[model samples]
Target: MGASQPGGPSLPQERRLVTAIPGPKSVELMERRNKAVARGVSTTLPVFVTRSGGGVVEDVDGNSLIDFGSGIAVTSVGNSAEAVVRRATEQLQRFTHTCFMVTPYDSYVAVAEQLNELTPGDHEKRTALFNSGAEAVENAVKIARAYTKRTAVVVFDHGYHGRTNLTMALTAKNMPYKESFGPFAPEVYRVPVAYPFRWLTGAENCADEAAAAAIDAVTKQIGAHNVAAVVIEPILGEGGFIEPAKGFLPKIVEFCRENGIVFVADEIQTGFCRTGEWFACDDEGIVPDLITTAKGIAGGLPLAAVTGRAEIMDAAHAGGLGGTYGGNPVACAAALGAIETMRAHDLNGAAQRIGEVMKGRLNTIAEKNPAIGEVRGRGAMIAIELVKPGTKEPAADYAGAIAKACHAEGLLVLTAGTYGNVLRFLPPLVMPEHLLVEGLDILEKAIAQVTA
Candidate 1:
């Protein structure tokens, strides 16, 4: 049996290290996993987890590690949240799955209702649940096409949609996600995002001008009348949490409105209060025609959703919008609990507090280290870009070494962005301030040591 954590039944605050990171047991299990699992799959951190709670993950080897990655931002309310576990367990005991499309259930409808009410905009909205972020994104494209009767969809550079065929086409990065998986779906086009940190045009360019250039490029390449939708993450996720300039999203929305093209926000990674707001798009007061969500929605359960204006969503035929396991009852139950936890704990507020702490520390480090290029993100979704001193050239190898050092010292961080030189932080909103500070100290020391 795995070790039982302390601090009552619900929340555990301890990080107990019973053995080395991949001790004898974990190394053995990893070898087995390699044989059984596909080689295409990869892991970002070592220390295989068997159980997690609040802010810590307990590995099979019985070492408790502070989790900064939050299962890649899925466990926003924290792992094994009391409400989420209770609701999921109860639903499991009662009924596991009824296949919502075959025989609808109240839980599925309830989840849909929550999406409608919670997603940005006061406009009348409709929602459909699916099994993953990729599925939700694909379905949104279908809905947009049905509504506009158009063939073209536009996505921005550095934006990550998902892994499915259509979504892989939507994703901006070429390798890993879209590699070896193409012949991708056609009618999908890419536009450049105004990444102030790396844009050759310079950050001094106004948001409006940058946006106009992108819009003009799209209109010139593919007539707006032929475009069904333009999808984006308000703050790009895997592509380095790049937040577009102030006017970019509003400009895109205005262009979409004039052309009758749908605007979809892929909030899978930034949703559920990860960005200090319910939706990252909320920051700009932009209401997307359709919003796709997954990551933190079901509190670690496999559930995703597409929420949008009712009229646009209804364009799809009844049978065109569902999956066998869409809105699984247990997952819906977990979602209900997750939402409740967010409200009760004020995870949005927590995210803002964490962001202040993170940005403050990272910026302080940047002041001292010439190798640090940029620090950016909102709320809990933060990243630090590494570069060679006095140059914009990326230092991916240096970043990799720093990450390896952190792992050796029991801290886990993830690398992202096209250049692979940015270290992104996705700590659970429920993490303790003390633990967060400790991790920051370790991160700062590692960078100092490496740069020296």
Candidate 2:
């Protein structure tokens, strides 16, 4: 979708429900899915979306539900974004699949150039494209390991990387994501994250303590020389959008530098202006050795990348990094259009506007609902932690109930965190003001209902 011409009809902004949520058509599809699909796979929401655009998902049931999850923050530009669709369709018309490793395309090179220019860090950089966030993270690890000639990788508690074997080792949560899928990749260690609201120590000491504890773990267990990289999300994504303390990131970077440990910023969820900035790591002014991104890249097409210092990236010998679908021509085309759309419409500014509106509404809810313990996050990626009154213990039951209520009210929301007590809102940056406010109102009512 390119920019609108002089006077085309503006996109519709309201949710129009012509039938009950999960109406006849959706129910029929679910029945078919259960019979044909494997039961092992998991789903966050039940409604089957037939068409999506702007800020809403039109379910097969004919109910238009406001989308706050953005397909888990994938469709940043918007579902069926005109620019992305146009570019992708045009590219597809030319050719479907050529396999970059076999035959390269200019679009792939263009995408890599954009990542090198846009990603944080002013140093000379190079990028490698991949299939998913986990693939990118895995590739980053390969590069780090090859560069540093080390095997150990460290991750923080409550952090989520992905579901692959190595990433499963990096992820901290046990249930759902990693449950019953054990025997994960080895040489991975976990340390406590600076979770201020729930942490025992004051915010003043948490950052230093967390950093120290991690360094200690690396030194005592694996030794600094044996470690390849320390991976972290500047603003934890599924880990409740928890913002680390002021000095936390810098200390980590300093420690990494001293130990020659590659600091990998897992920007899969926090990249693409989702957190008010181009990358959340930029806010701290820390230059991670490597940055991993996906989800929003290519405007929902499967594309992920690892951008890092050229030397480190070059450590991988010939044919060391790449995938069959990595940098698919159509996906690259979509990414180019997505980047243009973000700049043309100033979606970053819109994300800040979204954050302000969401914060105001969630703070008001926290004031009235004792179950809400914290309202946190930056930009469009925001979350509210639920807890019992006068205690810091997570209230996952209340969070689940609230989510169910929101879905029933035609507002799609998602829950995350190790305890599953944090409700995260990841609405598209193109979301209309009124629709966003309406979703917030629904969220308030849902929380109130659950609390009552």
Candidate 3:
């Protein structure tokens, strides 16, 4: 039997390495996948997953690996959570889809109600459901443009929105996300973010100088009157999980407010107790005009939402929004169950505790390893930047080596960052303390071996 985790029930929680990491079964599947799957669709860890619950993912190879990635922060309440499974199963037994737009469902309305009540602001709010983060973000921009009657959309460096054409223009990274996929949608402006670790001057002056520089550029170049929205990730997700300098977001929020531009918080990775709060915007009390959410919202189900002020949401014409499979009944049910699980288990507290534990361990690791340039991020979404010793040059090679080492040892870790030099950890909040410590121990060993 598996030990229980914080958020919900679990599978056999121990890390059981049977054969090797990619055992015979996984290797066979990989060979099959190589033939069937498209080359464009890549995988970080190729072990075919059979079951995942709480803090562990059981592979077809009969190995149970510690899940620190959480399906790229999609399983915040833990994979195959009890509530999610139960609710989704019940919904599946009934009606699978009639489509919310085609025929409304109570679960859709209920999920929207929960979102309206839970998202940052107290003002009257409305929520529109979509199938993915990209759709939600795309719709948020559309709503903003509709409300403001403007064309330009301002985005920041190191921000990751989604994979859609508009969001590809909004995202900052190249190579994987935007390389050769351009001739993207126009009227999207990119600006600087207060990335203290890579700031030109110094970390202390980063917030003020970077914010001022961003505002100045937006004003002079983009012309605030023509910009409909300023989209930013509260804590960057795919771009290394960089948390902007403390006062940075608030300054941008203020600027957006002054210019009548809808401030959109792309909290797809930072929301749903992942950042020790319901939303990252709550940390600094920075409310946005529109907030896009996904990833953790439905405990691994494909459900996304755009939640914002009622007036702003209503600005779109009657038939301007929605999709055929948007807010599928089963996904909506899973979302409600996920929300219930989060509240019932105090996942926010669980996330805060994870942050405390991870920071304490990560700080000690950074102290011993000069390759670790910086340790930053909040709650379950922690990351460490790798750099060359005695220099700021990104150690992307070291990052890759350590991650490979961890994979060989049965620890599931993910690499990120624009420079490809960041090791990001998004442990399930429900992960038991022992597993967390074990994962860290494996990481420490990998770091020592690789850096040495």
Best by lDDT: 3
Per-candidate TM-score against the hidden true structure: 0.96, 0.97, 0.98
Candidate lDDT (C-alpha), each: 0.87, 0.87, 0.92
> TM-score: which is higher, 1 or 3?
3
Give the per-residue lDDT of model 1 (tens digit) for 239-343: 988889888889999999998999999999999999999999999899999999998998899999999999999999979989888899999999998998888
Question: Which ranking of candidates, highest lDDT first?
Answer: 3, 2, 1
| Residue 247 error, candidate 1, Å | 1.1
Q: Pick the candidate with the highest TM-score.
A: 3
RMSD (Å) of each candidate, 1 decimal? 2.7, 2.1, 1.3
Which run of 10 residues does model 2 get worst, by summed lDDT? 1-10
lDDT of 3 by residue, 6-64 (tens): 34454767789997988999999999999999999999988999988778888998999
What's the C-alpha lDDT at position 180 in model 1?
83
In candidate 2, the residue pairs with backbone N, CA or C atoms under 3 Å apart (3 or more residues apart, or in different chains) clash, namely 1-82, 1-83
